[model samples]
Target: MTDRTLTVITHVDDPSIGVLEAAAADNSWSMTMVAPFRGDPLPGVADLDALVVLGGPQSAYEVQDHPYLSDEIAYLREAHAHEVPVLALCLGSQLLADALGGRSRPGDNGLECGFIDVTATDPESLLNGTFFSFHSDSADPPPDAEVLARSDRYLQAWRTGRSTAVQFHPELDGPGIEALLALEGAKLRQFGVDVDAIRESIPTSGPQPGRRLLDTWLDDVPVRDPAHH
Candidate 1:
């Protein structure tokens, strides 16, 4: 069996981490967690088999507020240039879109802060149905990017060349969803969100279907031959 390592960049202690860990373990791939704000960059990211950029509360356009956002985007660009497999989630996805010459803009309608259904724009296979969304920003796919999915609130997902970015949080499960609801309760309230309504919108069983989609996505990612590196 070929050994592969996937690097994950994260800022907050999200519940999705657990789901990702479980998914990687099941696939026999090891994962290394790194915080760009704390950890130093790897010597050669190309050596890594796959890359996963996780979400944060920061916006991709707020480079001045969070300088590391630029660094992370640069790193993603380098990885993409090297043709390394990449999957970007939430803010990470916006960063990917921005790094590839696209723009992430604040939504005119407002924040999308619940379980929303996304329709597949293309038969790309990695994304097909509804996904959990929790962002206030929207991204326009780069010129070379192919749109894979979308929803009423924003551009739900897109794929550019070898990389894919999703605005939704597929890694979130029951507990994670609950935690988010608790943490962002004030924000939700300010937006006139009803807690019971939000809770009711989320299925009691968590996002198993989304997990299945992720499993299929991992299998579809083009594995690189170690010999090439």
Candidate 2:
């Protein structure tokens, strides 16, 4: 008998999760990517091992503009119902929360771009650490979900069942962060952000800790049923 390589499906809203791709490879997981924003179809969760939803510039409430946001929410809801482990970041987190009876809306405190330190509810949580952030919206996770971490300004991480969600971008390295900033340059400038200052604050130890956090998810999150692969 041969062991089948686990397959992880990633929904890419932006192509900045290289760190996550690397970590998935390290764990010998093969990837299947779907980009609903680009009109790609989402796959059924029953055959997959895990689902990873990456951050995006779109708001969770903008279904009229980006109709695919509705599709993603429905898809994630299905995945959760089947007990598939989901790893959602930033915009992805908001969508997951909404699918599971939570609400996502414009951040009352405004955009949180750049590196920020988050407090972990558990002192030794892998979700703890300074992570790169970029979001103008926030999510209040489902009423039954366990809150894992938070910053002084916003909710950072939460988990329910086999799924996990984090508002920060642990998948981005320095260049990746720069690329995201460039995408949102005009908005940042409009908000009086010093683009150069945020550039200087990019942490050298970014990708390493991010990978470790991912490793924890893969190793620790309980799987209900073995995937077909």
Candidate 3:
């Protein structure tokens, strides 16, 4: 087994997969993608160094509509119980919050689409600057979770123990964002999101800075020894 293998759980096909693949390549880490649609789970989740849960179109409350969500939540809860380092984005964040006793509900401000600025609550944490957000629902974090950032749209980011969840897409780069716009242009237009405006908002750069932030957060996390648990 590789010393630094990360398990990624995602629903459907996301344009940001290339970004994540590149990040893993840079880190010299092995990754195994587990798509819920394919009915696959981590073989030995406890042996993983990190867990990454990606965004999905469905809300956390729609477990009845999507049976895989129940299984996914269970797996996430198990990972949390073991103190695994988990980074959840968008709908995955909402699921992580719900799995940790938080409540996921319809966002009061409706859908938070396009690019938005997130104010950092804990500058010492992983998320310290602006991020890309696209979601229709928000979450009320559990007591165990710490609010790390906020935006006008919804709870931008939160953390509980070793697990960190963000309502934004820090893993997305310029090209990835463009691919998403192309794929969901019609939907975005329906929401009154101007394609040019969204394109202008995306920073024309890489994700090294954001990856460094994530690495910092990982450094602060206490690595788990199998014997301890």
Highest TM-score scorer: 1
Between candidates 1 and 3, the lDDT winner: 1
Better of 1 and 2 by TM-score: 1
- What is the lDDT of every predicted structure here? 0.78, 0.80, 0.77
Worst 10 contiguous positions by lDDT, candidate 1 = 11-20
Estimate TM-scores for all models: 0.91, 0.89, 0.90
Candidate 3 ranges beyond 4 A from true positions: 123-126, 206-209, 218-224
**Model 3 local distance difference test score:** 0.77
Model 2 lDDT, residue 144, Cα: 92
Model 1 Cα lDDT, one tens digit per residue, 37-100: 6655653765768888888888889999889888988888888888887889998898998889
TM-score of 2: 0.89
State each model's C-alpha RMSD to the native: 2.0, 2.7, 2.3
- TM-score of model 3 relative to the true fold? 0.90
> Which digits, one per residue and each the tens of the lDDT, describe model 2 over residues 53-124?
888768898999989999989988988888888889888899999999899999988878777888899998
Q: What would the per-residue lDDT of candidate 3 be over residues 115-169, giving only the tens digit for each residue? A: 7777778767556666667788988997888888898767888888888888888
